[model samples]
Target: MTARAMTQHTEKLADKWGAHFPAAELEVLAAAGYGARMGFGERPALLVVDVTYSFCGTSPMPVLDAVRANRRSCGAWAWEAVGSMRRLIDAARTAQLPVVYSTMLDPGDAAYEPGLWGAKNARGKEDSPAPAAGPRRDNDVVDDIRPAPGDLVVAKGKPSIFHGTNLLDHLIARGVDSLIICGGTSSGCVYASAVDGFSHNLKVTVVRDACFDRVETPHWASLLDIDMKYGDVIGIDEAVAHLGGLTCRVS
Candidate 1:
C-alpha cells in the first residue's frame, strides 16, 4: 500500500476510538483537477441530498439554530443555504439540466438507522432498543423543497449518495459529467458523496454556501478537507459564475 493510504487507514482506526484524528493527505491529491479553472464539460446537474424533515427543523437532531448562529448577519445560515440551493435549482432548470434529489430510505429497522441509534447511543442507555417503524412518504424530503412531478428522487441506504443507489447511472444517463452538490450534514453525507463522485470521474464542485452540519468544527473541517483533496470548494457566487460559463460556453 502507498504510504498515504497507510496514514488514512491509521487515522480511521484512531477515529473509531473517539480520538482526534486528521483526514489523510491522500484525498488532497484529487483537488487540483476540480479547481475553478478546469475543463468541466457541459451537462452539469444540481444534486441535493437529504433535505428532508427528519434531518431538518426540530425532528430530534436539529442543528439549524447552530448553523444560523454561525452565519451571523445573514441571519439563518441553514435557511440561507436552502434559499441559495433553491436558486441553484432554478438555474439548473433554466439550463435544462437534471436535478437529482436524494434522501435516506425508510429505515424500517431502528437498529439499522444510525440517527435512531444516535439517540440511544447519546443517552448511554445500555440495552439496545428495538427498531421503530421506518418513516413513511410523509417523512420524505422537507415539504418546502420537495421535488415536483418531473424531478428525480432517489432513496439511498447510507450517508454517501452513490452508495446502494443508481445516482451515478442516472447522472450518466443524463450526460452529466459535472456535479454541483448541495444540502446537509457537510462532514457526513456531503463529504461522502464528493469522495465517491471524484472516484467515479465526475468533476465535483461543492457550494459552501449551500451545505450545513450539526456542528461548526466538522462543517469547517469537512470543507477544508474537500477543498484540499476531494473537489473544488467554491462559494455560491463562484459556482454561479461557473454555471454561467457553462451556459455562455466561456472557457
Candidate 2:
C-alpha cells in the first residue's frame, strides 16, 4: 500500500478504538505536570529491541509462518520502520553513543522448559512447533541494520530486554543516563523495555515512527501510554536531530 493509504488505514483503526487520546485530556495532563519533558541527558544510548526476522518476517521461519497465519501480523509495517531505525542508529553511531541490540534467540533445549512467556503466549502451546524442515535462523537481526563490531548485542528470552540480561549494568557502566529505543513490536518488547527504562530512572525516548506493532490500535495506545507515563514518543527525524545536536566526542 502507498504510504498515504497506510497512514489513513492506521488512522481509521485508531479512531475506531479510541486509541488517540483526546486533546483535552492531554491538556489536562500537561496542566497536572504529568507529561513533563525530561529532555535528553549528557550521555544517551540507543536500545534497539527485537528487530529480528521472527518478528519482521525478513526471512522465512516457522515462527514467522505462524505469526502470518494469525492475520494480526504487522510484518509489513515492521519492515517499513526499519529505514527510520537505521537512520537513528547511524546518527547515534556518528555521535559516538553506545548502540545496543536485543534479540530473542532460540533457547535450544530451554525451548522445552515450562513458563517460557513466548510459548505461554502461543495460545497456551507448550512450544512453537518448528517447521518440519527448513532454515531456522529466525532470531537473527535483519541484515540491513545488523549490529556491528563494538555494538552490544544481548540475547534475551523475555519481552523486556532488561528482565534477564545485563543491559542495565552495561548502560550504567557506559555512563548512559538516557535511552533512545526503537524496534518491534511496539506494544510488546518496545513497551516493556520503555517501562523498565523509566523504572530504572533512565530518561527514555521512544522513536514512534521507528517502532511497529502486530496491530494498529495497540500500537497507538501503547505509544500514548508510554508518552504519558513512561517516556517521550517522538518521531525519527526529531531523534536524529537530537543526536546531531550532540557535541562531537573522541571515540
Q: Work out the TM-score per prediction.
A: 0.68, 0.80
What lDDT does candidate 2 reach at residue 131? Answer: 38
Q: Tens digit of lDDT per residue, candidate 1, span 1-251? A: 56775555444433432233343433233232222223455677888987765456423323545324221112244555787787777777666678889876654534344545445343324223333235434236766666877789987767799987888888878778888899877888889998899898887888888897766788877876776566776778877766665655422
**Best candidate per lDDT, number?**
2
lDDT tens digits, residue span 90-201, model 2: 9998898999999874645354333556443644343344531355356678898999999999888677999878999999999999999999888999999999999999
CA-only RMSD, every prediction:
9.4, 7.8
Q: Any residue pairs clashing in model 2, and if so which?
A: none
lDDT of 1: 0.66
